[model samples]
Target: MQRLTQLITCLLGTLLFGAAAAADAILPKPFTATYEVTYRGMRAGQITFKLTRDDATGRYTYETTADPSFLARIVISNAAVERSVMEIGPNGVRPLEWSLDDGKPGTARDGQLQFDWNKKLVTGVIEGEKIELPLEPGLQDRLSIQIDVVTSLLRGEEPGLIPLIDDNRVKRYSYVKKETTSIDTKLGKLDAIVYESTRQGSSRQSRFWLVPDREYLAARAEQIRKGKVETVMVLQSVQ
Candidate 1:
């Protein structure tokens, strides 16, 4: 059979060139994330992001949880840099690498997280340097951490580069609205786009509930600030 049609056309051209060189790392595979943030009313704390994606180098592994006994008082608990993030690229977030809780070893105060994809804005750096956050113009009604929708959920179009693992420290924002959305539970539903300055603002409507033919993004909905009260988060399983 012509050598099985040239070995099935070389396995379909090596799976379409590995899915176009991984179209930016293809959503980081394995999923299971839940975040419920609120303001102006109270319940302003809840985070759970457990990720894993390493299908032969797509590379990614996260673990963030909240309410570790609410950590003491005034509601400013470090939660150890949101349980020490580490997303290397697809945007960038390198917050901590060691000593947490008491903070100190590298002192990453847990602040400043500037993102601005495409146009390339990239912020947040500790120990190695660069950190100056303090910008708000459209979003951010004092979100403790969800920084404009969590790096628009690990974007990818250029070899998966969106990992900001904190460095240098102390940045109090200056501007952010570069698009961010997520509602994925092992590809069930809810998927919005945009992540870093798509010209400028106005495009933050989200709704999710996938699975019709899924692979990721579980449940999502965001909007309604100012007076607060609009929020939707679902996705209770992923591995």
Candidate 2:
């Protein structure tokens, strides 16, 4: 009877440990996804997004590269890149650094930001100007904000106002959960949850169709201004 009791206790401990491990594995596995970009109903460009992690440091790097078509290049860039490096902790995902390149050499649109949590400040250079802004809890960079939304949805929580550093200023965008619907994509049909995000005091709205099965990745995204669609992106492939 004593041996049997010890075995049962050990089994129970193992089960609890397994449950904790599963809970900690909520984040999506690293992946590379590509999308077809459109502007005003015309084929414009392609975007490749990548998410990678450093197991040793528990840090993540999310990057997006945009290659525009010749016509699109007139409005956009030949090649643009945005990257965010962040870490997840008790307070949530915190961005340590972020950088953007508009693909124009010596252009003013290229900049980078460094976050200092200990000092509660974010310092960066934007458009040939220096910036130093006070940091608030739950602050995020442009790329990290997407991960924050995905993390919140996976945890069964509503994604509230996202405070992110844009350019040289902090902007707040509120996300509103809409509906669950089926969307046709290059990979086939998928069920996705629709979300609309609007910047405070702005008429421009962004919409996302996130597939839960794909780790809440956006299968389709659009930008609307005054009820007119300005830009759209559809998932083309993932690996």
Candidate 3:
């Protein structure tokens, strides 16, 4: 049960967002989306994602909530929440803060991080331990990384290797374009561009099916481990 809960939480962490448009390209948009989550071919739960913007400050708050289903509730009792606060600029999305609450308060899985771009550092607490790391160019948090990738795609640019702060360490993920395909969703059948992302030195890979006509929204996503699909999230609705 503990292992299953952990896998579900990991799937929730990988879910992406549907973004808005900027002056010349699509940027992060304030919207709400829902996805039906499945784990190991079984219905697991649902994930709700929201992105809100402070128009005056131009800062965006992206959040996601994972609610386990009735069957899954036996093992996963609480909903996990992840949030990232960031801004979009000429370069790309810059994450200012990131946090995760695994639904259990006071547990080691809960953490918060603050990014100080001026100081060129990221300071935070994870697993009840303090951490500080030097910032790198184009650094992003877990949630913001997807937005950055989508932004690059919207601009007709390839999102090669992206460096993001994951938990206590900075990890790099390589994004590669895959063949274009069509998928059936609640909204109807739509064409999508597939992109695969793999973390360095890991066998786990995630694939995203994004619909370009709909502002590059992710229509479906799957997390694969050892070449076998472990979790899947399909778009239910978007607004």
Estimate TM-scores for all models: 0.23, 0.87, 0.90
Give the deviation of candidate 3 from the true structure as CA RMSD.
Answer: 2.5
**Cα shift from native, residue 185, model 3 (Å):** 1.2
Q: How good is model 3 by TM-score?
A: 0.90
Better of 2 and 3 by TM-score: 3
Per-residue lDDT tens digits for candidate 1, residues 2-102, read 22111111111000001112364333344445545433234435545555545676444454444322422244343433322333443333322221232
Ranking the candidates on lDDT from highest down gives 3, 2, 1
The Cα local distance difference test for each model comes to 0.32, 0.71, 0.78
Question: Candidate 2, residues 152-230: lDDT per residue as tens digits?
Answer: 7667778788797876788888888889999988878989888888877877788888777766767788877789987
Cα lDDT of model 3 by residue, 1-239, tens digit: 14554454444433454444357465666788888888889998887888898989989899877678888777564577778999888788889998877776466767788999999999999778787999998998878876788778777788899897766788888888888999998989999888888877888888888888887777888889999999888988878
Kindly provide the TM-score of model 2 when superposed on the true structure, using C-alpha atoms. Answer: 0.87
Model 3 worst lDDT run, 10 consecutive residues? 9-18
- Measured over all alpha carbons after superposition, the RMSD of each candidate to the real structure, in angstroms, is 20.6, 14.0, 2.5
TM-score of 1: 0.23
What value does the lDDT take at residue 164 in candidate 2?
78
Model 3 / residue 86 / CA error / Å = 0.3
The candidate that achieves the highest TM-score relative to the unseen native structure = 3
